[model samples]
Target: AQSVTQPDIHITVSEGASLELRCNYSYGATPYLFWYVQSPGQGLQLLLKYFSGDTLVQGIKGFEAEFKRSQSSFNLRKPSVHWSDAAEYFCAVGVGRSQGNLIFGKGTKLSVKP
Candidate 1:
């Protein structure tokens, strides 16, 4: 079985501060990892992914994630945060690779301060 874990249910940061969302995954072998963001009342949008080759992958909206095989972790980081950046972030893993099914974490809700 494959699963994703987002330890933090919610996080708050100043509008100009830095941000980091933690994620952990479990799978039998190399898994397709991803990060997505969803604004309130909106659908999920792809943030970034790690399939092969480079462990560090860049994504849209000034986001980047590093896949650490040794730790089974894929943490998302942002050098600076903005008010519009507030949203629900999810870390997911592609299961049933051929079927294209996904197992997603509970998600982390981000709040930005003025």
Candidate 2:
């Protein structure tokens, strides 16, 4: 079975400061890692994913993540955040099952300061 753990349940970052969210996973084989962001009363938008190739992957809104195989960690980072970026961010692992639904972490709520 595959599973994910997000150390931080929530986070708050200033409007222009950098941000980082930690994620760790456990799976039998290499799993597809993804990061998604959800705003108030909105659906989740894919931030990024790691299927193969380079360990580091980039996503929308100036976000990026580095996949560390040894540590089984995929952490999301952004150089600078905006007030509009305030929302709940979820880290998920996609399993290669018939259903494509993702197993998501608890989610980290980002509060950008003005």
lDDT of each: 0.95, 0.91
Over 1-114, each residue of candidate 1 has an lDDT whose tens digit, in order, gives 688999999999998899999999999888899999999999999999999999999999999999999999999999999999999999999986697989999999999999
Tell me the deviation in Å of residue 102 in model 1: 0.4
TM-scores vs. true structure, each candidate: 0.97, 0.94
Error of 2 at 60 (Å): 0.6
Query: Candidate 1's error at 19, in angstroms?
Result: 0.7
Q: Where is model 1 more than 4 Å wrong at Cα?
A: none
Q: How many clashes in each structure?
A: 0, 0
How much is the lDDT of residue 92 in candidate 1? 96
Model 2: lowest-lDDT 10 consecutive positions: 94-103
Model 1 lDDT-worst window of ten: 94-103
